[model samples]
Target chain A: MYIESQHNDRVREWARLKTRRGRQKSGLFLVEGERLVTELLASHVHLEALLYNAALDEPPDAVWNHPKSVDRRFVLSPQAFALIADTETPQGLIAVAAIPKVDPHYPSRVLVLDAVQDPGNVGTLIRSAEAFGFDEIVFGTGTVDPYSPKVVRASMGGLFRVRVIAADPARYLAAWRRRHAQGTIVATAADAAERCDRAALGEQLALVIGNEARGVSDALRALADRTVAIPMAGKAESLNAAMAGTILLYEAYRQAANGAT
Target chain B: MYIESQHNDRVREWARLKTRRGRQKSGLFLVEGERLVTELLASHVHLEALLYNAALDEPPDAVWNHPKSVDRRFVLSPQAFALIADTETPQGLIAVAAIPKVDPHYPSRVLVLDAVQDPGNVGTLIRSAEAFGFDEIVFGTGTVDPYSPKVVRASMGGLFRVRVIAADPARYLAAWRRRHAQGTIVATAADAAERCDRAALGEQLALVIGNEARGVSDALRALADRTVAIPMAGKAESLNAAMAGTILLYEAYRQAANGAT
Candidate 1:
């Protein structure tokens, strides 16, 4: 059925999914645009609904075969779409889903984010982690919500394959530290003497990525088993958070692929 | 002198610098925020003026030392400052400066950007370019202007150190092909047989980074002497533009430093 009224309760709830508090309160979040909605359909995710402006856009109507089990599918008026869509140029489709619920299993190689505030950075890191074989991403306290629209878009369907969870990173590491005494918990520093490649990153690893302005927090840095630095050949003070984390992931991937440290 | 009206010709002109054509007309652009403004003053950039909100923000008075030769300095009212600023939260200060005119020399190491459009991605690549010892960044046809406010902020002062220029990439690269017959002209592809690190990168290098959606254009890819793929050990089809380009830069740096091919 087509919904025309902006005052409709169903439309209001979809609009609320654009914000963090709304997503948390409703236990739902939105994945907007044709690309992301297409990814949602392809993944084994629980779809609460598929919202679209059938009169305005070609996709979802053109590409998607509505699954019989998905109980709610609504065609919205252009006005209602304008109210609910997050992107400036809405592609006339949105996928509403419960925050992805999966059994949280710790992979040997994981990327731990500590208070990363930028949504773009958070999403890019997730994409990089997946490309380099990180199986899980731990979003610790103060990190941006991975399910937010900007991050979800920036991830470019990468997060669909990687499991995401929120937990106290330091406490989580403490448990892993006891189990894998030979494992490495590496952190990047601007001035540390050992180059990232010089340090022997081993088969079992958990790398901690810090915030933009502040490096890894003092207490969190203290938890690290060792530290490594990306060698700067020029005068740049440091690489951005995303670049630094990605370089380390690449290094770990390189070492594991070849029998070299 | 304190200016209260947005109607003032000088205040109006500063507001116009927010747009690309306006900046082209005036040969100037705006840099906002305390951190960036501080970097501007410390660099040897030609300053046309300093405009600040005398009432609301602490930066213009607290951090800035009025350089004696800057021809125009105005203490603007909050309303006028609001009109002139581009950022969502206007930092109390803005610096208007001439578009940098330093002659861009071809370093042995160069990063050629081909239509990579996102301002944040452009800036982050510039930072990585600088960090990895790339001496020049060439903004080829269809790429975003390097001097825009968002790119400037995201660059975090790295663009200040590196030489930036705009040219048709194919023509510029053709000139290099004559000079360095043995030098590696690297382009990244996801399916290429040679992995990035396995490629014999040398002291002289030019790498072409393509647009986000479409990989390097057909014509530009033809100019490349060698193609190297970043080895992905997992299911991710590709990495984002910034991450992909930065990894190539890191690999180039490592090879050059280690006397390895």
Candidate 2:
């Protein structure tokens, strides 16, 4: 059916999901662009509704069989698509999907973000973690909402792949360290115990990245096995949190790859 | 002098430097925030002018006596400061400075950015390169203006510390290979000959990073001594160019540090 009326209840409901509270209450979020929609269909995510420009042809046969997928797709005018898209240029496709349930207990290299408030930085870190073979990501207090549109876009579809769990950093670290006694907990700091190159990041490890303005909290710092810093030769005060975390994650990936072969 | 008149020629001239054409023609660019102004004062850059809110106390004696110092000073009202500042929260200082000359010689562990147009990514890559000990950064054709306000802010003053040069990758790489026979050119690609983990990046290396949409150009790809991919276990199709470049730069730093001690 054509979404002809601006006052339609369904349209208003979808628009409201732009807010955090609305998204949480409905267990639904919006995804835009053809690439993201294609990936979502390929993955385990359940689609509540699919909206697209009427000019485009029907979706391929492979995407039509999912039981929970929306069948009453709306044909949006170009102006309507533009209004709904977050970007300056709308890519002509958008969908409302059920938030995929993430397994909280997944065992692998995990990244713990502590109060990193910048949405772009958090999203880029998640993308980097996924690129470097990390299986899980956890967000501590004061961090930006990972499902926010800015973070979601910055992650480049990594949100769909990595298991993201939000909780308290200190409690999560203490519990995880106690359970996996042998696993290393390396946290990035400006003034640290050892440079990352010298620190022994083991096969089972958790990397803790901290806030943009402040480094890691004192309590979380104490919980870490060791604090690792990226060595600086030039006068740069420090690297961005996402860049620092990405470097460390890739280092772990390098070490593990070398050890395996 | 107090900048009371909005129509003042000097005020209008300083404002024009925010544009690429104005910056290029006048050979002057704007740096905002207290931290970056302090960095520029400490670096080799020559400041053309320093502007700040009239309410703040005079800068320290050391800031004025730097080898390459602030040539002119102006005091503006808080409203004017906000108008001139790139960020929402102005830190009460901005400076117009001359671009320092940097040698374009073959560098050890150089970063080659191929049309990575995001200003923040460009700045972040430059900052990471400095943190990881890459000596020089070269921007390929089609890249965004490095001196843009967003790039300058995101770099966190790394622009003052690092050696930045612009060139066409095809021409630069061809000449670089001939000039330095021992150096290795490593281009990052999604599907390539070797994973970045296994590549020997410690020696004199030029790491080529590509644009957001397209991977490295064919001309540049053909010039690479080896093409390397960051291994991905998750479903993400690619990594952000800055993140990928940062990981590779840090890997080189790790190897170089290991070899040094």
Candidate 3:
């Protein structure tokens, strides 16, 4: 069936998923842009529907073969396309997909986010972790929702590539310490322990980043095996939390690549 | 002379400085939030004016006595404060400051940006450079203006602490090579040179980051002493440019901290 009406109930329902509450209720989120749609098709993600304007180019034939593909791909008018797209310049394509289920596993190289309220930061960190070879990201309480539109855009399709699970970071860290008994937990701090450059970051590590305003929670910090800092020579007090975590992730990659650690 | 009129010419002029053209013509830019204002006051930057509402707790006396005192300070109503602040929650303080003139110099450790257009990326890169001890940042053509409000806010006061100058990056790199005769010029590429982790990044280096879509310009790449990439194990095609640069910067910092060549 074609979704020709602007006030169509199904169309409005998909549009409403832009809100956090609506997305949670439906367990669905929207993806835009040709590149992102292409990525979603390549990944093992389930797409409920794909919408595009006839004027725009068609998506690849492979996109239609996904297990959850709906019967019809709607052709929206230019106006309808504009309404659906988050970007000012509509890419003329959008997909409604169920949020990928993330298993709450004790990942070997995990990223722990503590109250990183900016959706963009959360998203960029996920992208960086994926880029630098980290497998899983765990968001602590007070962090922004990973599925927010801003984060999904900022991540540049990283949302589909990484496992993102949410939990109370302090409790998770405590539990990991009690269970794993062998994994290393490194947290970034301004003035503590050895500098990150010189620290012995082992392969099985959990890196923790904290809130934009407050540093890592005291409980999380207390549970860390080491609190390392990126050394500074300039007047700036600290790096952005995302950048801080990226630096550490790359550092770990460097050590692993060189077989130094 | 306290001016209370909503239509006051000065108020109107200050409000207009929010735009790039307005900032260029007036040689002033807005810094909102108390933390940035405090940093601006402490730096050598010239404060054109300071505007705040009575609700804010008075800043420490030392903040106002910095050599660059505001030419004027206005206490406005909350409504007036909202008109000037970019943020929804006005921090009750905003200052207009003269753009600091950066002395263009070819330093041993410099960051060269090419068309990295995201204001947040530029800002965070500047912050990372400051944290990891890079000396100067040189923006190529097509790069976003570092002084834009969004960039300044994301920088977290790194703007005041770092030396940032703009230049045609391609020509600058070519000229620097001829002048220095032996400095290492490292450009990041997806499919070239050694992995960034194992590259022999030397003491005297200029790190170049490229556009978000195209990577580095062909001319700039040709000028590079070597091209390197951050090794990736995950399915991500590439790292965010700022994250890639931050990783490279911390690698440099690590090498330097260890006194390794």
lDDT (Cα atoms) of all candidates against the true structure:
0.82, 0.77, 0.79
Q: For residues B18-128, could you state the per-residue lDDT of candidate 1 as single tens digits?
A: 888888899898888778777777777777888778786454553455663255677899889999899878878888888887655766788999999999889889989
Where model 1 places Cα greater than 4 Å from the true spot, the runs are A3-26, A54-59, A62-64, A68-70, A77-84, A87-89, A177-181, A235-237, B2-13, B54-59, B68-71, B77-83, B177-182, B234-238
lDDT of 1 at B194: 88
Query: Tens digits of per-residue lDDT for model 2 on B92-124?
Result: 788888977676877656788899899978888
**Per-prediction share of native contacts kept:** 0.71, 0.69, 0.78
Cα lDDT over the full model 3: 0.79
DockQ of each: 0.57, 0.50, 0.52
Least lDDT summed over 10 consecutive residues: which range in candidate 3 chain A? A59-68
Q: Which order, best to worst by TM-score? A: 1, 2, 3
Can you list the residue pairs that collide in candidate 1? none
**Best candidate (score: lDDT):** 1
TM-score of chain A of each: 0.94, 0.89, 0.90
Residue range A20-59, candidate 1, lDDT tens digits? 9998899898888777777777777778888778667455
Candidate 3 lDDT over residue span B1-261, tens digit each: 355666778888888888878888988899988789887877777888878766567744555545565457777766666677888787777888898777667777888999899997888788888877775888789999887889999888888878878899977877677666778999998877588767778878899998878999998888888998878776435477777778888887777777888
Lowest-sum lDDT 10-residue window in model 1 chain B: B61-70
